[model samples]
Target: MDTTQLKHLLGEMTRAEKIGQMVQLAGEFYKEEDSENTGPMHEMNMTPKKMTVSGSVLGISGAETLINIQKEHLAKSRLGIPLLFMADVVHGYRTIFPVPLAMASTWQPELVEESANVSATEAAVSGLHVTFAPMVDLVRDARWGRVMESTGEDPYLNQLYARAFVRGYQGQDLKNDPFSVAACVKHFAGYGAPVAGREYNTVELSERTLKEMYLPAYQAGISEGSKLVMTAFNSLEGVPATANKPLMRETLRKELGFEGVLISDWASVGELIPHGIAKDLKQAGELAIQAGVDIEMMTGGYLNYLNELIDEGKVSEELLNEAVWRILTLKNELGLFENPYRGANSELENNLVFSKEHREKARIVAEESIVLLKNEKQVLPLTHHQKVALIVPEDQSKDVLGPWSWKGEPSESVSVYEGLLNHISKEAIVVKTIDHSKNDRPKDWLDDVSTADVIVAALGESSYMSGEGASRSNIKLPAEQIQVIKELRTLNKPIVLILFNGRPLDLTDVVQDVDSILEAWFPGTEAGTAIGNILYGTKNPSGKLTMSFPRAVGQVPLYYNQDNTGRPLTAYNQEDKYLSRYLDVDNRPLFPFGYGLSYTQFSYSPMKVTLSKSEREQTDKIIVETTITNSGKVTGSEVVQLYIRDKVGQVVRPIKELKRFKKILLEPGEVATILFELNQQDLEYVHQDLSVSVESGEFDLMIGSNSEEVETTTVYLELKKNE
Candidate 1:
């Protein structure tokens, strides 16, 4: 339909119908059978009329189900607008890949884009028009369970990944594409930095800090043409994000230039009541609509109270019309009127869902996503000839897919045990399950543990222990698993700890005993194949940690980039009592960001910076070049990272921040020169007064294998006036 037809449909819509168009209901409400009213719908006392003409449905998929619902919906409406189907296709749909955290470890935005393309292809065929995904929230506190969904801690990296996701999901042309689903960049404006890392807690940050650190990734998604933005569940400063007009309307729509639909998170509009901002549901509707939320997800705030509020002259119909117009335009853009089925085909779904080709891509992603954390005395890449004793956690098989599996089945996932079996001879492997519930050690288990040439202790938190609503106060391995590790230590055998988890864990206690550690964060469907390949040296582990792993829970918000303190901890002042150093432990993460070990070693030459002129101008660019050699005997890949520090600024600046990085693969004795270019524009930051500008100053540049270890150099940047 054209703009004229969309306006005509809007003119014909009654207040009730218009409100329905702005409200999104759950899939259960539209089900043909199953009269069981679950928590959300029953509590809202949603009317039947609202259910029939609802604008969209959430958490529903499949061509048959969506087609039946759309048919029923269109038949009941005077002016038919087919129901929009959406689901939380966060990672992948049916063919699950590694979680977003693992994908970030690959440091390959194109690979992530390919994964998203496969995800979009699978999801679009299954009848989903939108995916509430590519969560670009920059995370520092791993205690937040949703860290698995985010790219990582750094803004630049998150920005890159967010763009890749948008490109992958929406493709080049959203209107003409059937394989691409509209990407919804979500948790807008600081949902990641909850107080004490609690879920749905208050996010308190200065406006400058918010703009400088947290808001870039969301803006990047918008720059890449994301079709929608989802409001975060947390309250920004004092205002709940859903009802914060300043943020949702002024900063996002005007300042950032986002001209798209703004949707509330699940029941977030109603949640404003408990947030103490709204007195009742009516007030919630008034605030949300006024704040520029075009769609309400799984809530009756719009359907129940929007029309009444408008009738009372408390809310304007013009505001309601604007929302309805955006919704109608989206449907029209999706070509729903032209084809109600929208590109959903059962035959395509059957062929593409979890196909061999997609699984192979998943295997490649999984292999690159696994991080080799520690390999003491070169104990990793175990030969197949070694008799291996594998001790896996009780929930190992069940939790392979991690959280947000949605349509993915655990039965389809390959566990560590299965992967080992596939790699090594069955006779050479002795498997023992360590029941996390019990402390008993059977004689057979102890006998196998002592006799085997090597022990592979596969342990981690269960999938349920992380993700949404699964925050933990103590981010450590389970006590039972640690106890089993202690028992394994007695045998004096090489213990390789393969950790399967979502968030970064406090590994200070366990790392000392384990000879080698591979952090395979829920390698999805091809988990076994990827882990097996990495184990037998068929694949070298090239993954790096996106988030810093803390040595203790006391360092809850630890990260590599931090502001310099007045009393800094220097080598000369190491014995100074007043220095900003922890007495019990050093102020360093257990594993720094971008820290990962490889089977082979790599060496870097001194970095050189070449400026276009001796004195730089604003337009002048500087080229930073470094040579990396595979100094070890084997071929391997290394993630070369570039970090920068501003010596003096208008305000305090971080000691170091990741600016650019490159992943290079080198054969033995082969050298390659990597280059990164930067200008004055790249060094700009938001000042305390909300002005964005770059200061002329001296800066420190460092190129490193990881955040903590680097070769340092100094450079100066000066901006000259345009002639």
Candidate 2:
């Protein structure tokens, strides 16, 4: 449908029909039994007629179910407008991949893009129109359960991932592509910085901080042509984002150039009442429509009260028409009018869902996402001849497919014990599947542990421990699991801790008990196969920490790019009382961001910096080059990171900020000169007044394996005078 057709559809819609287009409901509400005024329908005061015109249905997939529902809905519709189906296809639909946090650790946007394309392919065939994914919220606090959904804390990396995800999900032609699904970048404004890392908590940040730190990723998604944007549950500066007009309209829509449909997060529009901004659902609907929230998900705030508000002149008819128009435009763009079933086909779904080709891609992605945190005296790459004890909770392996994998079956996931059997003989490996929660440790378990030359202890938080409302105050291994590790340490055997988790955990105690630690963060369906390959030298671990692993839970919001305080503790003033030092612990993370170990080592030579001109203009580029050599005797991959520190700024700057990074694969004794180019935009920072600026001053250009361990060189930037 063209613009003229969409306008005609909008004009043909009645006041109530237009209001219905701004409402979204779950799959259960579309059932034949729901036609009667009872259950959720009665609760939301929705009539049979109103249900026929709902703009979208979420949490519904599978080609057969959606076809039946859409057939039923269009049959009852006066205008024959099809219902849009959306779901939270965060990581995958059926062929599960690692969580977004794990994907970010790979630092390979192209690979991430491929994973997303696979997800879109599966989801499109499964009857999904939009996927609320590429959750580009920049998360610093690992205590926030939703950190597993975001790319990481860095804006530059998040921006790269956001664009990649949008490109992959929407493809080159979203409207014409059957394999692609419209991507919805979520929680638009400061959703990740919830106070105390608690879910749905208030977010208090300066406008400058919000734009500088959180908004870039969402902006990147929009710039890459994501079709939809979802609002955050948290309030920014006492205004809930669903009802925050300046944020949704001014910053997101106008400044960021997001002309796409803006939908509220699940029940967020109705949440404005609890947020103290609305007296009732009517007021909530008024504020949301005013704030430019086109669709209210899982709530009847728009359907129940939008018409009344419009009748009372509290909400404009123009706003209602615009929202409905956008919804119609999206349906048209999806080619729903021509073929309401889009790409949904049960036959295609069966062939594509968790197919061998898709699972292979998942295994490859999961392999790159496993970070080797510690390898003392080269304890890893276990020999097949040696006896190995695989210590794990009986049911923990099934939880490898983490949260938001609505369609993935845990039973299909490969277990760690099974993964080991792929490489090592079953007779040589003893699997002690003990319940970690049990108080009594069997004598047989201890005897099995004593017999092994090396203990591969598989442990960490379960799928339920992290992701959406699973925030924890103590971000560490459970006490029972810690005690089990402590007891195993007495065996005097080399211990390899294979951690399965969603976020960066405080590993202060575990570091002492284990000789090697492999951070295998919920590696989806092929979890065991990927870890097995890495453990047996078939594959090298190249993943790095996207978020810092705090040494203690007290450093809840620890990140690499933190601003240096006025009283920052320096090496010379280490013992100073007034400095910014922790009284009980060191002010360093267990492992810094971009910190990961490989089976082989790489060394970097002194960096060389060259300016395009001696007195560089803002348009001229600055080139930095460094030679990285595979110093060890085995092939490996390394992520060479480039960071910049501005000596002076209008506002205080972070100690260092990651600007560019490249992942290079090198053979034994191979040397490669890595080069990076930067301009004034790379050096720009958000000021207190919310204006971005790049000052003329010296910047410390640092290159290294990680954020903390870097070699530095100084360069000056002199901007040309304005005419």
The residue pairs found clashing in candidate 1 are: none
Report the CA-based lDDT of candidate 2 relative to the real structure.
Answer: 0.90
Question: For candidate 2, which ten residues in a row score worst on lDDT?
Answer: 611-620
- CA lDDT, every model vs. true structure: 0.88, 0.90
TM-score of every prediction relative to native: 0.98, 0.98
Tens digit per residue, CA lDDT, model 1, 416-516: 77888877888988888878767687755788668799999888988898898978888999988888898899899999998888899999889999999
Best by TM-score: 2
